[model samples]
Target: MANKVYNFSAGPSVLPEQALKEASAACIDFENSGISILSMSHRSKPIENMFAQTEQYLRELMGIPEDYDIVFLGGGCSLLFCMLPMNFLDQNATADYALTGVWANKAYKEAKQFGNALAACDTKSETYSRIDKNLKLSDNATYLHVTANNTIYGTEWHNFPKPKSGFLMADVSSDFLARKINVSDFGVVYGGAQKNISCAGVTVTIIKKGLLGKVNRTIPTMLNFQTHIDAANMFNTPPVFAVYVMNRTLKWLKDFGGVDAIEKVNRSKAALLYSALDNSKVFVGTAAKEDRSIMNVPFVFNKDVVAADKADDLAKEFLEFAKARGLQQLKGHRSVGGFRASIYNAMPVEGVQALVDCLGDFEKKVLG
Candidate 1:
């Protein structure tokens, strides 16, 4: 087996080692059920139990209200950008979007193509460095859409804004299933499972049971949230292996003391790395201090000391240096250049400390 390297990729990110090991065993022969999870029939009793158990575990872990229907659907969180509006928006219906970063912008654009979309608040002019508090929400909106964490910009809403009208909807792909949240606060919460839950093939949608089936748009059966809910997330051939892995992951999280326990570790990990950046003269965090994300941390060299012309080159150099030291995927997203370390739920606190130590060592060598 190859030595396990610390991975910080924003999506398809690191998973718990125990979960991986268990999945490896199950993939070979799932509970000695005489077939792999992938080989088993999606309609078979075994797979059905896996699906039901996974849903139950996730609901329990997140404290989802009995009024909510948790459905594992196809397509990523991006699909929800369209599905959400298609299911709720109609003539004269508008949705309020908080354009905080790239993901939110994309969601707004998609929703706008279908129906009226109002930008309640936009931080594009600020290069998405922070969230705008003085949001002008639409009074007649159907729902307020927001991305809880800006993965590329390394900014997050520590607390969600209060919308004046309509229910609150969030795309929390990067932070979903990671920590404790008041599920009752949201009308809809959706995420792609690639980051905190499982792999890339499955998307999770948790919505209020009675809120769907009101839109005038005639969506295809597969795209309809109500269809998926009615079928119990088994309408079509679901991502069997992905759901199995997610089930194992949820079990691991439960055994590890659920979201509350993991969130404490997440906070400590982020604090360690942010403290290291603050202490380093050569390195500075990119996001506003209060808006810094606990999941993704982007840092850059102080431009006063280092020329901006060399920022990209320096970032590339540091990425290679860290990779050689067993830190993988430290490069930031291409649109926003810098180094981003994604410390997800599965990433251990030791991994964060190692990265922090590497940052200090690099700063000392480059600027001391």
Candidate 2:
């Protein structure tokens, strides 16, 4: 068993050790200001500098275009769900949504309150095991919304869809900053900072300048993307400590060779676990092979090896077994009755190897 604990939580998940160390220090005296980041004013210079540097690092890492504007909001993607429809979906114009997973459904349902938002492709009936490539998006629709990664179901959209006439928008909460993305591919790319970027309380949004002013409805000042853009994401009081931590995380990522390098590492880690699952006699992955997520890997004890009625017991046993070896939060979502290994950016190859070894040991014991 490893001495260091490996966290597999989906969000509010693992962050780089360097970021955590620096953030801990900042809690007492941020940038020699003699005040904690939690106590610093949002309008202060240090906070402003932190915000700018975070955005700049994000821009460089993701190759975000100059035409796009970045902002950090108080609410996570849940808030962006309503904001998206209010700012873009006009009363006359319709928007299309890709029903990918739980979050996607929630976002789609939220959009229904603002305007006529239809599902371009729905995989709910199929248990969201794969990304539907053949999307029936309407050419005249205002925008097409897609969730880049399905956290619960362990599926990811490897290839993004293109809208004929309207722009594309994406909620990339679970997979944010985990890989390289083309900024020009979407009108908006937004997600919570907790997953692959920073801690909770702040959501990062990158919006294309051309998408605004298209909606005729009156959006509240805070809900309006333009408001934050004008204020540089300091319209009211921003989440100070979260942004400070995010800045540190971004700096760590930059020093670690940016998104491209981390992406290679991410892919390697995912491959190791998935390969183990593919060859395992005791475990079987839930998500479709083609659409498997690199960030989250959900699998269960093989029903063929263990009876369905006893699967839960076996899962519990395995979770306890893994936890004893310093693995934490390997439990799957309550809705998904198995185990999920969330190998986010901070999750190293060694951690994945530990999990793979644990899985193998458990498999042997189960078989024996």
Candidate 3:
């Protein structure tokens, strides 16, 4: 701890320090190749090897099967919001979505614009504080789309619902590549790399080989998943720097025992913060315990000490206080009016313990 602050932004969030250092060293002349990854031609052997290794590492880290086509596409997960429907949704076929939070709603809205889409279940009325377990799937649905984690509302689906129809698709943007998951459960799993994998600029899409090519809709070449798959994700100039950094991060993950080890640390960090909230009289968690997200934890100050209108003020104060004490990005998203602490894979157990200690100290100083 060199008096540095911990970052917890939802996306474009924290990355492993070792990865950052390695990237910094390679920024100028990557392995003495005399060219930065950014300056290299996408078709060059050096860059090609980088791309191949990165893709292979990602597949190995996540245990992705050989049948799945792993493509590193440009544009964030938001782009897939449009591409998924364009590639999968036929004229008469409907897609079913489970709206758990802001991101899920965005995906649903985009899918509806392209073709018929239905919400299997939505918790908007309750401000997305919990997951809807009793969702009714459509028999005619071409695919069931769901967001595995709600970064803003701090809700996550620990156990995914089985779709009754054709295939299962998930936008695990915030939680993808963070924990151990069965790759066979989903036909398509896509995520923006900014959250747990790397920085912004690239999105990873894993699609089962046979599940594509059914849609009669004519998708643009760039937006089509098969285009990138056919080109080995070099269809256009990919996000070279971002992909390089992701490769470094994936290597770091493997060095640290991959997803299983990181997941244990994640669980411990989340448990510590949740325990602090549960034990403290000054704080209360907003999301349901069972459905709470391990990556992003949302909590509110006690109503008796902090009014609803002043909640923002209190949060701002807490942000400043935590910043001074080496904690960073603890403020919640604007959509949900509470404080959020995003403990992604990069966040260590010590950081969570420090946050818990800060909470106790703040409570003692302010409300005691």
Best by TM-score: 2
Better of 2 and 3 by TM-score: 2
Residue 312 in candidate 1, Cα distance off native in Å: 3.2
lDDT of 1 by residue, 1-368 (tens): 24358999999999888889988988778878978766888999988998999999988999998999988976777888888788877756889999999999988988887788999889888889888867888887888888998999999889998778878998889997666778888899988998988988899989987788777778998888888888998888888888887898899999999999999989999999999999888888889999999999988788886798887788788887788779999887776677889999999998998898888888877886
Q: Write the per-residue lDDT of candidate 3 for residues 5-110, one digit (tens) a residue.
A: 8887787899999989878877888878988766789899988998999999988989999999998977888989988999989878899999999889999999
Give stretches of model 1 more than 4 Å off: 1-4
TM-score of each: 0.97, 0.98, 0.97
Best by the lDDT measure = 2
In model 2, the runs with Cα more than 4 Å from the true position are: none
Q: Candidate 2 — worst ten consecutive residues by lDDT sum?
A: 122-131
Which digits, one per residue and each the tens of the lDDT, describe model 2 over residues 1-368? 55679999988899999999999999899989989888888888888888888888888989998999998888877999888889888877889999988999999999999888999898878878788889888869888999999999999999888887688899889899888888898999999989998899999888898789888888888889899999988889988888888888889989999888999999999999999999999999999999999999999888889998888788899999999989999998877769899999999899999999999999999999
Candidate 3 global lDDT = 0.88
Query: Each candidate: what lDDT?
Result: 0.87, 0.90, 0.88
